[model samples]
Target: MESLSCSLFSYPVSKCSSFTRLSRGIVFASRSDSKKHHHKKPHLPKNLRHRRRTELPPDFHPVLHPVPCEGPPSESDSAALPRDYDENDVNDSYDGNVVWESDEIEAISSLFQGRVPQKPGKSSRERPLPLPLPHKIRPLGFPTPKNIIRTHLACSARQPISNQIYKNPAFLISLARDIRSLPPEDNVSKVLDQWSRFLRKGSLSLTVRELGHMGLPDRALHVFCWIQNEPHLFPDDRVLASTVEVLARAHELKMPFDLDKFISLASRSVYEAMVKGFIKGGNLKLAWRLLSAATEGKRMLDPSVYAKLILEIGKNPDKRTLVLPLLEELAKRDDLKLTQQDCTAIMKVCTKLGKFDILEALYNWFKKSGSVPSVVMYTTLIQSRYLENKYRDAMAVVWEMESSNCLLDLPAYRVLIKLFVALNDVSRTGRYFSKLKESGFTPTYDIYRDVIGIYMASGRLAKCKEIRREAEMAGYKVG
Candidate 1:
């Protein structure tokens, strides 16, 4: 076995050293020989390395030896160290340097509160037992040497609750397991009370977010209620966002989760999960209710939510009528800048409701925003004018659309067909009607009626009957 030795050297120890000083001349000796030791003076802390040693007091001892490491003692150069201070070796352990207060012990003891075994003497199987340390300090599942326990204590009692919860993986794991095992109807406060020692604003929010990821909407909602009742932890925007995520995950969004509370705090991933859940449930009224809560400044939602709205509207075109209230609410928020798509949706609603003034206002708003009006916007305006019997203005919008050189969409083609039919211009009406079919624009029931009416008025029963048959083949119930 390799041998150990010591060499006495007097050096000034820093006042800030954690371990208590034994003697001024105490210095540790190396166990192995290598040139690397010559390069480094010793393992002195950075602050102490460049400091010069101070003069020893007149009464200072000439030599003192370092306490040896824990192992069998091999050969040692005894002549290098003095034997006079051997009695001081008993105080060398690192635990003796600092003291733990009563409050700290109580804080640590709270971690294993109910899990500690109450009665130690009576056990059915006691074959493999541990050494008897004091019951207060012996944590459950402790297997390390007793000397290392102070490190654990220092780690636990030294931090605030917010940081402590994040550091203890065992604590977080136990918390998740306990919450998962709870029944949906049982009070979440019970589980929360069990771990009340570690509760904080950050911990509560983290639990809710994790529950959302685990898909536990019921428990998440319950714990969120507890957060509100607890007076110490002030629930902020981050906390509100996490709670919203839990409900949105299960497609259980409602008024309690006011998303406008933190319009920017929640992430897109949460909204994506919400949109998917809504699509799977085959209902959008719940989603619309939640979105409608968004006030003036927060009028815009995540793009993913709007994309899903478009997808759902495509699958069930009649649902467009359901968005009328939300559209009107958004249109009233003058400060809210809207996209072309938003303009189109609002105009469609305005036309259906015969709100000609609102439609004209929306068109003027978009025009003032420095963006050229889209083909659909102009088309909605033309149809609105024609509905109000403003033939002069309707024809004027057609002239402007042609001057803008914008490609006509399906709505523009239908408006032209209706306008020409109203003017008793059969030739122009037939031209636009053929283009509608060739462009794969499925005509609505109203479009078919207008076309058949114009044909019958001009003495063409053969053409009217053929158009009626086409409408029936396309699944429209003609009267």
Candidate 2:
């Protein structure tokens, strides 16, 4: 085994065998060296090399020993640094002093040091600021002078200046005219801005009227409050009139104009405004209040306006109570010229409200005025009587129609026939039936049938047959 070992060690190694032999030698060396080095100190890299002294007294060792560290070398030990490193080192030192401070403090320090930090080039925060105040804003492409601004602001602050003289109104009117003159796409925003400024400064009434013309009454109302609060600038009567007309025209358009403020105007124009506004708003109570005011003021209330109010109330069957006083008021008007239409309106209201006293008053008024009661008037009264089952009174009305030379129209004859049949007065029904035939008028088939049925039901079959034969002979069918 010893001879074999010597031969193996003495053999010259091939290129491939050299690698294998070297690896085996390293393994043996490590195993042998581990045991010897177990009692020795570890060595470090040459750059970090230090001297070692073994013969040290009992408690005496180097005063300072180097330790493995992660950061740059201390200033005292930086002898190996490059010549250019000092400049960078100075800069780094300065940065280190600033980095720990807040940005505001650093900026203030920089300012005090007369080294204004170059402002960042157009960052979002450094971009041009918006106009600090609304009045300072000018239209794009329109440079406003400070003097012009002061003049405009002074003009705006005047309490009583007519809006007509204001630049904003003039500007808006001109812009709008220009827009209207130009094609649609040219500077619409400019026109709108001018209009906004105009509205801000213009008369409330005019603004409201213009907005109403544009079908924007709510916007008009918004502007109106501003005008109203500035009592130094009283709106002209024409402006108030135009506003009221607009309100009446766009009755359904909601407005924020306070009705109380309008009513407080108390002028003729304001009274007119209140009347029209209430009518437009469909508030009959307010309309009536205006009417009462007109009467108290002795101002002539237009009959057409009164007619509209009464008719509107009568049309709603639930609002019958509102009709009576209006009719009575009309009846009591001595200076008022009551036309046939007015009489007709009164009769209709009386019919709806069951106000026979008003009806009687209307009849007396018509007779005293030498106006003939229409066939409709008589028929309505007859029908009312029939509804009340006052057959005698309804018959009297029929007689009065004939006596008054008023032709008994179809409705009149129908009511009479129903009333007589309801009263079981077959003889009177026969008399009216004969009158209808002799007058060259054929009664409605329903009326004729109703008469025949009444006779038949009363066991007067012969009379029924007789009436049927007579009706057939008069070009009437007996069904």
Candidate 3:
């Protein structure tokens, strides 16, 4: 053992192959030489001999010490070692029963099972923990008092009610009605003040009517002239009638106004309205004078104005000669087209005067001019026939109206019933009354009065009383 230790220092085995070094550990040079040197152990190298002896146990053998080697392993040392036999070669030769030593396995198990703490190795890396799974998020709630999410909207209503005060025509009419209800006074300062502030297009007609009713013709004329100044305002017939009546009265007052003064001051509508108004007030001479002046001024007279004046002049029995000249002048005009209303008015005048030839001539002219007479015109013709006691002729005209698809209204039916009742034909009257009802005309107090009078005249007092009660039930005064 001593010589073996000394030989380890003498020759290093660093260059030796792994198999050669392992073979040298398992084999010896000779069994006899080993026995001869059994009592002589070789000395360790100086550095190895100086290693701390206290690190080893007392039972540890020096022969088991580790010695360092350098350079190549010696060939002679390797040759002296025993031959190595492979354990795998023995299994190829025979099948044998193998046994493990239980005591040796228990020793290794006991070494691991011991509770002694081991010293840490040079590596300091620790095992990483598994990443945590993602957490779930909750949804948002609806806006409410508890949620406190909504805000209040700002207000948009700031304009005053007075800004829209006169927007309603009823309010203006009521105001005029109230003013007219007051006592008659020449001082119209209050009306003027109200007019300046709240007057609109609708209020103009009401103001003129109220002023005319109050006998303040000058103030009414002032209001009518004010309408001429306002471009947006066109005075309607009600306003025109009132203004013209005031002008007719003003014309008779001997005011210092000439023809040119009047013409320059008033519009064509004013002059036309004045002519009609004068005729209405039983002053045909003044109406004729105005019409002649309007004609001489080269101003085109409205067809309605011409027809109306002619009809009114024809109403006067002494002035029947004047109507033909007016009709001749109307026929000569090429630019002025006759309206249905104008033709109907002319027909009515002719019917009133019993001029059937002229009436037929007017009707033919209107038809040729492409102006279809309305239901009112046909009813007028029927009434004219009835007035002459020509009942069959009137009925024939009604049939003509029906063939022409002209639907007679409630007034026309009333006229027919009246005509039949005049002829003492109760059955025909009843048939017309039923037709009136089927046409959805609810009988008013005036209609019921006519019906009651007819029944009483026919000696049907019970039917008259029944109609009176029905009229009373339908919210009409029986008396």
Candidate 4:
């Protein structure tokens, strides 16, 4: 191994191996000898030998170590340093104070202590530092400030019920009529979208009401069902009431299967609407069941609801079992006071049923309550008495209405015409027809047909023919 080591380099003492061959026969020392030689200063290259320094320049300062001293370095530090201080050993001993050139130290001191040169402004009397170029000034492409504020104000204004377009009952009625007038083939969604553009806000309840008035309760119920999925537009009581009335009226007028799907899917509000509508449509049995369900659920049962149910069920002798229970339930609640509308609904229902006794009882109740009867209530009462063959009482009610100077409506005039016709009093029927004309109300086809029938019954063939000719001229289809 000793001979092998000597022969590895081109030492003159040993040249036994070709591996030690070099240009100019230069020798490479072994690692141990090279490290021992480094204890003295390293030999400079031939080119740098002339500029070599015996010591560091006075201006070249040593690195000021941020590492703490365990104890002051001994004066014999150079004697203690290893013959070859490995780069790794130096770094480990002094926490890596790697480089400290004069330029680096100057650059670092300039970074923290130097005031950054400012650009010349129009006028600068020690102006403050520019605020960081304000985050690169990007555009978001939003509306202008004025337009934004106007839009916000408009939205805030529409939040109230009074100003909202959908809350305008008259507007809703007009929209409904317009929709009803459209060709059935017209796309309803397109029509609604067009109207929505003009309206500030749309309400589900008003839509239901319009649909109901247009006799499109099926569509209204469809809207009602759809709004369930819309988290924002939940239906309240008034919307439910309109939907119920529409459904009931539709049920009465349409085929049995028309609303069966919606009926099966009816929620609480819809169930209540069904109950009220059924009562209005004279479906006593179903109405009673719905009312019972509503009562059991402790849902909102107003006096008007009870009155309608009572009026309908009380008329049907077989359904009499249901009437008493509802009345008793109503009596249990003190919060409900009968409104004029409730009284009118009851009177109207009783008139249809020809239940004069109940009508008379309702009349007595109204009297005792000191509530003035409306024109509709008095008209209904007269019609009920006339239907029950109590001519004197009916006429007395009419005389009272005249004495009170009540505004007799179209319904009252129609009833009077019919009553006179049924009694075969031709002159009186004609007089009531004259009164209807004087009331500025247009006569319906049914009234024309009744008038012709009365004339024919009284043996006025010539007059009937003349009236029929006039009716035909006036676009009335004479049967």
Candidate 5:
């Protein structure tokens, strides 16, 4: 039987190369003889054959037949395969084992009960929802105790209420003088709280001013250190000014207040505040020191503040000594805006200092720039030259003033009369005297006195008598 089976498989294997030709012949041949011939021949090597033939029973041909060789099926046949099939029914008699095997695999996979393990790096926990942020708390819009303290300090320093409200001892002795006088409906607690906070801030100025008005300058000094050590809530000009005034008053009250420290604090204020404070305190030296520090440290002062300082200093007889040097320093700064007031102040300072050389340079600078000097500026220059005994230069400035149509007022005439009289130039003095009268400005007794002195000093008795008569005619009570 094995021999028969081997022969059956061997015949096909040996003729496999000629199967195409044999297939054509078999189609014409009788079926019985073809079957008998197909059962012959087993002479091929065993090792080259398929193992399935050896495992099967000899008689079990398993309906061995060649599948029709029409090649691969068309798309329409492939499309007819069922996508979903029952695994239990796949092995039914009509269907092949091949279909059963594929369907069983899909059914087994669909019945998977356990979850797959997560990837090595990932977590199963879903991302938690983000938490909302808390809202920010806003500050109160109303003024704080600090604001009231600052405002009260600023106002007190600027205009001391003590001097105006509680100047007398009776008002000072009454503890509730102003407090009791306030309307009953007023917020006394708020007012008291503000005052208490102001006191606690250790502002010596406000304390001193308040106490001084209450005739308690002694108690004011007792808390001077507290005021000195208190942290400045607002270190602006107004605050600094208050601090300075407080310290200055403390010093006046016989307290050992540090003048240098006070001046240093004053230096930090605006230039106007520092200058005015020093001037008011009659400390011109400290004013100059603060001015120098301000200019050197801040690099520039406000033009208006600088002008105010210059004007204030120029008007003071003692402080005027510092003007020329200050003006020179001011002129060196290119950023300084030289207004008419500044120019006039500089010219006046130069005249006072007899710095006619600088004045000439300034006048030429103004003229070349085509800027017409105002009456004050021209008069300042003329007065300055006259003070320097430069009669010709002084007269030249007067001519310039007249040409520019800058009216020479009484002050200008007084300056000219004084200048000419100083030079003992009788002819020039007489000429200016006639012009002064023509301008409808009668000479004062001082001017007449100056004219008479100039003529008498030159031994011109007749000219002196004529000046006396003119003085009498001009309503001067000449002795």
Candidate 6:
């Protein structure tokens, strides 16, 4: 029990306490569970505890229990066991040596039978294998900055105009009051030129907002125009929003003032945006008025501006008349260029309005603009020739389409079938009808009825019956 001989016997301990000698002179230390210890040795169960110099019987065997909070997760599959293993699991495999609890065995059995076992501290079931996800789950990332309500709140949380009193308030208030006093006929442009005082962009925006609250949008427009017209001042997005809001509140969506008078202000892009806004707002009349004004003022607006306007207006049959006026105005410009998309829109509008004569002139413009008419355009042109009793001209357009290697669309096929039928050309009609079927286009009831009439009039009953069956199959009962 004296100090243990260092070489003879050594055991890890905080202090070198007394050691007891066992039957074979093996030493064992009384370890103290002290605060100074960095790592505590693991505690083992009684049957698996360390034995000092004990001899075991010939058939004696031991099983090890899993120590918690150590190592990777337990494998559910027997095939995943480490080292030499078998069905009996009597070898040194991970599963064979470790003693499993009753609950763990049942859990693993249920897992193999497709019962998802909820893991400790995990809300979801731990899959036996790393299988694919049930479906693509969208990740809930951090709160997006572009959210509508949050952005609105953030904008509203900015320093308001009343709180802007400390940031040069006197000039903004005086300028707002001065603009408020002006007559409806007068604008800030007339008065701002008299003073050479430096003006901030925020000051101008504030004045417009103040005028908006005063219920005098005419006064607001005056402030906006002065800022827009002045080469030195920038009419930023905030200024534009305030002015438009004020004018909208005053029910002046259709501008009371001539839009072209300010077309030369600051940038052409500004007025182009305003024109597009008019079109988007469904004010075709106002949009057309602006186009006419831009034309008269010799301000060349973006072709896309009117192109978009024309395309939108042409969508409604009732608005087809509006398309012709825009085209005519655009025609006045010899240097004007239009895309094939816009020309296709024009052809549609022209076909609806029965403006057959204008197609020839449009072709000349297309050639001059270096844009080829699309297949839809050629279809409309051929239909134009057909309606005008110009069969040869329609055939000429067909030849042009073939030369352009344009594949026959549904409308084109129907037109060809009718065109040949109009001339008592049964062979071509049959050819087109067969091609239309090969193209996987379900013939319309009208086209089927027309083709059947052609085959019937020519005493071709078999072809007529086949087309009738096909029509019925297409969910159309052809007479």
RMSD of each: 28.0, 30.9, 29.0, 28.7, 24.6, 19.8
Please identify which of the two predictions, 1 or 5, would achieve the higher lDDT against the true structure.
Answer: 1
Q: In model 2, which range of ten residues has the least summed lDDT?
A: 12-21
Show the lowest summed lDDT stretch of 10 residues, model 4: 1-10
Give residue 81's error in model 1 in angstroms.
99
Tens digits of per-residue lDDT for model 3, 142-187:
5355743222122213533333443444555555565565566634
lDDT of 6: 0.65
Off by over 4 Å in 4: 1-290, 293-301, 308-336, 422-428, 449-468, 475-479
Top candidate (TM-score): 6
lDDT of 5 by residue, 1-479 (tens): 01111111122122111221122223111122223333433222333233333332222112223334355645644344334322232122112211112323333433342233234567778899777554434554764565332233335667555432333334323323454445646533333334333232323344345654554434444434333444443233443454445444333522226644544443434335545545555565665676776665654555555555666677767767667667677667666556666666666666666677877776676667667788777777777766666788777877777787778888888888888787678897888888888988878888888888888899999988888887788788666
lDDT over C-alpha atoms for residue 397 of model 4: 82
lDDT of 2 by residue, 30-147 (tens): 1112223233333323322332433222211213211223465556444333333332322222121121113333334344334344444665655676758765564557555665
Ranked candidates (TM-score, high to low): 6, 3, 5, 2, 4, 1
Candidate 6 lDDT by residue in tens digits, 66-151: 22323433454322433332223221222332333334344444444443633346556566866567454556667577744222
Best-fitting candidate, scored by lDDT:
6
**Residue lDDT tens for model 1, 1-479:** 21132333422222112222245434432221222222322233333334355422231222334456456544453343344434234243233334333333333443433233234367786787777679756678856766632224356687666456643545654666678887867787778776665665565666776776777777777777777777766554455666765676576875346556544554544444455555445657656654655434454555435435543554455676655555555555546666788667667766776778978887888788898988878888998999999987999888888898888877788788889887898998898788788877788988899999999999999999999999999998777
Per residue, candidate 4 scores C-alpha lDDT tens digits across 279-359 of 666777667766676666566656777887776665666766666576568557756479888878767765665556766
lDDT score of residue 471 within candidate 2: 76
Task: Kindly report which residue stretches of model 6 are placed more than 4 angstroms away from their true locations once superposed.
Answer: 1-261, 264-266, 314-324
Decoy 6 TM-score against native: 0.47
Q: Which ranges of candidate 3 are over 4 A from the true structure? A: 1-168, 181-186, 194-205, 214-244, 249-257, 264-266, 335-342, 365-372, 382-396, 404-479
Q: Local error of candidate 1 at 17, Å?
A: 99
User: lDDT of all the models against the reference?
Assistant: 0.63, 0.58, 0.62, 0.62, 0.53, 0.65
Clashes of each: 0, 0, 3, 0, 2, 0
Per-prediction TM-score to the true structure, in the order listed: 0.37, 0.39, 0.44, 0.38, 0.41, 0.47
